[model samples]
Target: MTLQFSATALFAHHGGFGINVNPFETNLINLIIVIGVLVWFLRGFLGGMLERRRQAILADLSDAEDRLTRATAELTRAQGDLAAAQQKAETIRRDGVARAAAVREESEKRTIEEMARLKEDAVADLNAEAARVSDLLRREAARQAIEKALASLPKKLDAAAQSRLIDQSIRNLGNA
Candidate 1:
């Protein structure tokens, strides 16, 4: 009346776990038929889809190429514009330098001329001052000489000399 367990019975096969060599029992022929039918039916659809995808990829590549070409052209144009601007700036800089040099030269010339004119004017003023001083000295000398002569004349003359000088002056006047 005891129950016994066997490890072999638990793992025993009822002919359901082995490889089958018969194609019909394994349904291998049906699987092949179904695969062949699906391939035949979906071939056109799959090919059309692949072709459309390829065309889209080519169009995208063409668009990218066009953009690259346009970008290159724009870059070239910008570089040319930059070169022209730089050339113009250089020209302006040269012109400014030349103009500055000319102005400096003109300023120097004017300064030299003005200095010469001032020097001439100073010389003329000095000459005028010298002439004025010389003329004043001559007038002073003459005045002093006249004062000395009048002062000595009163001392040298007496009453008899003054009477004879007066008699002689009257005779000269009568003759004239």
Candidate 2:
């Protein structure tokens, strides 16, 4: 068999398969051999197409492997980020707790101070009231004593008589 692409007009209108079947067309062995060659050629063409499909499938697999690697790395990064976020949240929670406790303690301290201030004010008011009452009582007692002394003054006596009365009262008190 000789290679002859030029002799075979690719698109002849007659579509004769480019074969001269005048004599060999009637020979049984020659016909069988021609059929075998056609089958062999068809198989070669189909096999090449199958090989290209297999190569394309292998390329798709390689691309899928690369995508899987990138996806795994992204998942690892996402997990790390999640852990960091959790730690940050915990820190915030602790800070919030501390701030709340501080606020409560400050509020308690302020409440205690206000209570102490109110108590002091009440005690001061009570002391002032007691002082005013004692002063009023003292004034009343002094007025009564002055009135009694004034009323007895006229009946007491002159200065020399009062002096002698005072000395006699002292001697009588010493003897008792």
Candidate 3:
């Protein structure tokens, strides 16, 4: 290529300063000309490639920022949901405790009532048993007294007294 030939010519002509202060030497001028031409030819291509790369990087950065925002919103929403769930759990626990207490109180009341009813029934049963025992004792005493009276009355009676008692019984029957 022409660029390779020019670069080779410029290098081949390179020489020492040898106390010469001239900056426009043949090799330096040739090198400058070659560099200037290469820049002019490649500027548009390199610039366009760099610009596309920069746009892609910007797009990637924008996408990353959007993802970060969405993630932040999701995290906040999750935190709120957690808080609500905790509150709900606490409410359920409180309700359960209240219900348990109420049930316990009700159970205690029922137990007390049952005990009272049983005690009343027991007292009534004892009273009924006492009454029955008293009635039995009274009947036994009356029967014993009647038996004793019947046993002694006959031994205490005489023949004259029996005859008089027979005469009186016959008179009472005639009056009736």
Candidate 4:
């Protein structure tokens, strides 16, 4: 209440709040006094507060920088690992392709060799069968010739010749 009364009295004494006595000088002097008192009382407190806030901001910045570095290192390592995996995959794929080609070539070679062997076997079997057939044909021809000779031998001889031969055989038998 006294503060309010004193403020009212001061304002009343200053020409009743009007443009009479050039209030700029009085108001400026009052503002300067108030600001001076506030500075005098609160300077160390404000300075300490500003210093603590600055340290906190610096610490946050340092922490952010460290996190960024760590994140960058992790990204680099991940990229390296990805590249290594890709290289390994490529190597494996190449090896698989080479092995498949080798296997196919080997299989083809084996198939050809097997075909050749089968052809040789077939030819040998054909030769053996031909030889057996030839031998059988020769035996059949010899048998037929012998039968014909036997069938024609009596027809080829005459009756006179047979009588003479019989007389000679009887004489030779009497001598024996």
Candidate 5:
């Protein structure tokens, strides 16, 4: 075939006018072919890129969830430890208070015992002193009575008369 710009020229110039081609119908097959190849190429490259981006976003979301879970677990453990520490502190406080009370009670009991012992000793000393004073008073009274009787005796009484009177008085008192 000969290369020509117009159909009439290719036909040996025998026609004055030729049939015109429609724009829509002429390019329809070519458009379908070109668009098909383009769709095929983009479906692999661009679709894979979008898939990777989606996977990366999902991985990030999962990592965030894991970190939140770990943090919550740690917080719960710390709270439990705090509660245990508080309980231990309260127990220690109670024990200390009990020990203090016991010490106070012991001191009070010792003090009372010592006071009672002191009171007993004081009473014993008082009884001894009273006995000593009573004995001294009795001895003094006896001495005074003896001295009065001796002083009242007459100085003029002769030994013989005194002896005879003492003997006669002794005999009469004995009989009575």
Candidate 6:
């Protein structure tokens, strides 16, 4: 075959390259029809998938909210329990302090009472000792007086006087 180099055959039309306004000649109408068919066919499938995904997200959000509510309630209950425990501990502390003070006061009172009793006993012992010593001194003085009188009696009395005194003592003994 022979190659024919004709400029009229190389370019079928005499117009140069430019934007084509005719949709059929440029195949733009076929592209629109193909896109419209694909959108219509896949609309239900894609819509169903998106609806299911949205429902799943809503359910997850609801579950998270419920968990948050439960956690908050539990925290509140724990705080209440902690407050009650603290109050109970404070009450116990106050009671312990009061009891300790009462015990201390009672101990002091006992100590004071014991001291008073010991003081009374000491005073009684002192009075008894003084009385005993006074009695002893009186007895000693009486004995000495009798001895002195007896010692002087021998010098002062003669035999006749001694006989008269003896006779008077016998008469006195007889009367008793």
Query: For residues 67-163, what per-residue lDDT tens digits would candidate 1 score against the true structure?
Result: 9999999999999999999999999999999999999999999999999999999999999999999888876875686567546766789868766
Residues 25-101 of candidate 6: C-alpha lDDT, one tens digit per residue: 55677789999988998788898899999999999999999999999999999999999999999999999999999
Q: Pick the candidate with the highest TM-score.
A: 6
lDDT-wise, the better of 4 and 6 is 6
Over the full model, what C-alpha lDDT does candidate 1 score relative to the true structure? 0.80
Off by over 4 Å in 1: 1-21, 135-176
Tell me the spans in candidate 4 whose CA falls farther than 4 Å from its real position: 1-30, 149-176
Separately for all candidates shown, the number of backbone clashes (residues 3 or more apart, or on different chains) is 0, 0, 0, 0, 0, 0
Off by over 4 Å in 3: 1-25, 146-176
Ranking by TM-score: 6, 3, 4, 2, 1, 5
Q: Which candidate's lDDT is highest?
A: 6
TM-score of each: 0.62, 0.64, 0.68, 0.66, 0.58, 0.69
Question: lDDT per residue, candidate 4, 1-176, as tens digits?
Answer: 22123445666777566433334534655677899999987888898999999999999999999999999999999999999999999999999999999999999999999999999999999999999998888767756765575466558767786567557656854774
Model 6 residue 16 CA deviation (Å) reads 4.6
* Model 4: ten consecutive residues of lowest lDDT: 1-10
Clashing pairs in 1: none
C-alpha lDDT values of all predictions: 0.80, 0.80, 0.80, 0.79, 0.80, 0.81
**What ranges in model 5 sit over 4 Å off?**
1-39, 149-176
- What value does the lDDT take at residue 59 in candidate 5? 100
* Predicted candidate 2 versus true structure: per-residue lDDT over 1-176, tens digit per residue: 32233334533724755554445333556668989999899888989999999999999999999999999999999999999999999999999999999999999999999999999999999999999999989878766865675568658778787667667656854774
Residue 47: error of model 1 in Å? Answer: 2.0
